[model samples]
Target: MVSDRMNSRAALWRVAAGQRGYFTAAQALRAGYSYQTQRYHARRGNWLAIDRALYRFREFSDLPAEGDEQLVRWSLWSKGSAVVSHATALAAHDLGTANPSRIHLTVPRGFRQKSDAVILHRAELAEPDVEDRAGYRVTTPLRALAEYAADGEDQDVLDGAVAEALEQGLVTRRKLLHAAQALGARAELGVERALGAML
Candidate 1:
């Protein structure tokens, strides 16, 4: 029984490691924690309940966490179907001029969930459009800027972010243009306007 418990802890740790120490109740159940066992662990302070159906290990972190934990939480909350996007992705790549107050997430076109904490964009994404962040996913810099333009974000912010991304080698000029062209007329025009101003 002791060995079984240890093994469960090890498995749960592996799962939480990829999520900045956050895990869902479903994950705990899969890790061999029964409902009663979970309650016992929670009461004993071995696990800290951070949100509805969500938990973090007591020893894995200090109080007052950072943005990475928030990203992990929402990614898990979306059942891993969403990617950090728009202004949030721009900020993550250090490419934007605007300090957006809300976190942005991109879900599939079929996704129907709503949340006040996140501004969600719905579209089907090709595999190459997403970049893995170890604990979560985000749109690539080129894609992020293009999506911003497509959505009619402030042109100044788009121009600044695109220029910064290009200057920092986060995206190639050719690929940036190509992605914009593929997004739509609005996105392509916005990108063209930004690039034209540079010349």
Candidate 2:
């Protein structure tokens, strides 16, 4: 029979071996353990709870602590169909500021999640309209910029994002113009013009 210490070690190992650092209480429980047990181990320095049922490896496991990027990643894990959008996607494209506090996530119209940090947008996504950003798949550069510009934030921020996007070669003038035209007369013309000026 396995001792409590051995079981705790095994559970910790499971968390260390997986690509995911976050695990729900139900997941830990289903893995032949209890949530309280996991908590006990964490209290004993065998693990570190991130948030909710989410956890990370103990310091001795040599695993890095889950940081903002990891939280964003966890948010993605929680949202299987979510695509990075708006400012989050713009940042991913290196077209805007970095490490936004409120991570923007877009999923299909009916998808939802439990995260409050995520600014969720329900929009239709075409397969070709997305791309892999630093291993996290997100909306394409042009689409991301367009979405942010349309979000009705300060127009200057949108212009800067579009400018950076063009400077980084993540988007083309023609693409931006076409997208603006599609968005019609109500679209932010300044941001579109910024795109045009760059190309």
Predicted model with the maximum lDDT: 1
Candidate 1 residue pairs that clash: none
Give the worst 10-residue stretch by lDDT in candidate 2: 59-68
Compute the lDDT for candidate 2.
0.65
Task: Give per-residue CA lDDT, model 2, range 32-136, as digits (tens).
Answer: 667678778668876666776666555423655443345345543553577777777767666656446787887777775657767888878888888753325
Clash pairs detected, candidate 2: none
lDDT of each prediction vs. the true structure? 0.86, 0.65
Tens digit of lDDT per residue, candidate 1, span 4-44? 99999999999998888889889999999998888888888
